[model samples]
Target: MNQYLLNGKLTAKPGHQEALAAILFQASKLVATAKGCRLYVIGKDKADSHSVYVTEIWDSKEDHDNSLKVEGVRELITQAMPLLDGPPAKGQELEIIGGTEI
Candidate 1:
């Protein structure tokens, strides 16, 4: 099976980190139900309270792209925009070499 990974950061506007994290956590639950989602983990940066990190593993690149189309996923993205400090952090797409099963 083809596997894809996304590791990125999201910076929240001042005093909005907790709110953003909550939204991300909610999105994680929604992503868990996605067909090809293997893992969706969200983390907060200790040094920067306004920064959040996300790590996702999908069965394929297509799966990852399609996830964005999910209604709940889309809603979360919309809800997060206003809390974001700027655009989401740029991330690299990696072909998963190996990983433990979810």
Candidate 2:
């Protein structure tokens, strides 16, 4: 089966980039042992000080969906909501074909 990949960006309110990055860092830790989790990486947008990007790879689309139910995830989402600049953009979903192993 093809792997599921998601590339998303979250824009934090002014002066909250660090705060938002912290939340996403927490999420990465929480999902480290979750079933089907492959990669959960966080990055900063070079030109956008307020933007944080997340790249995730999972065994399947279902695995990614089920990640939301993992313990502590919902709470983290709630915490992050107030730090956001506005509604988030929909993440880009991709099907993995091949890639260099990290």
Candidate 3:
């Protein structure tokens, strides 16, 4: 199977996790239902409440590339950026694993 992975963390203002939660929930649903989306997950840092991480995968590189152009995905990121206290650091990755969930 073809796959894609991404990781990012954002620093949000205190008491704003709830707000971020709403956006994340909506974004997550949009992403999870998107064409070729195999998996998508967002996780908050246990040690730092302001930090978050997402891991995602698609059925193929074409599907993955197309996902970047999805309007819902673009809107989600746009809506989320203002909530951050700092620039988000992100990295894209290809699958190379024992095949267990991350």
Candidate 4:
């Protein structure tokens, strides 16, 4: 099986983790039904109360890229941009070496 993983970090304004998390959670609802999306998770940084992370697993990179073109997802991205301290940082793209689901 082929898999694509993306990790993104969003630094929210001070005391805005809850608001940022809410948007992320709402985005997750849309991602949950996205084609080829395997896993879409949002988590808070353990040490930083104003940071949030999004972890996504997809069947392919193309599927993941296509997701961005989705109207709802695009809207969510727009909504999330202002809440972030800066541009969302992109992490390394990882190949799934192994996982319980596989």
TM-scores for all candidates: the values are: 0.91, 0.96, 0.75, 0.91
lDDT string, candidate 1, 3-91, tens digits: 99999899999999999999999999988888899889998776888899999999898988898888788888999999998898777
Return model 2's CA RMSD, one decimal.
1.0
* Number of residue pairs clashing in candidate 4, backbone atoms closer than 3 angstroms, sequence gap of 3 or more or interchain: 0
User: Number of backbone collisions per candidate, in order?
Assistant: 0, 0, 0, 0
For model 2, how does the per-residue alpha-carbon lDDT over 1-102 read when each residue is reduced to its tens digit? 989999999999999999999999999999988999999999997889999999999999999999999999999999999999999899999999998753
User: Against the hidden true structure, what lDDT does model 2 obtain?
Assistant: 0.95
Q: lDDT per prediction?
A: 0.88, 0.95, 0.70, 0.85
lDDT of 2 at 14: 98
Q: How far off is residue 13 in model 3, in Å?
A: 3.0
Q: Give the distance in Å from residue 97's predicted Cα in candidate 2 to where it truly belongs.
A: 1.1
TM-score of 1: 0.91
Write model 4 residue lDDT over 1-102, tens digit each, in one string: 679999878899887789889988988888788889999899876788889888999989998898887668888888888888878777778888786772
**What's model 1's lDDT at 27?**
91
- Estimate, for each residue in 1-102, the C-alpha lDDT of model 3 and write its tens digit: 636665555667776766776787777787676777877777787788766666667776677677767668788778888887767765567764547753
Descending-TM-score candidate ranking: 2, 1, 4, 3
In the predicted model 2, the residue pairs found to clash are none
Best model number under TM-score: 2
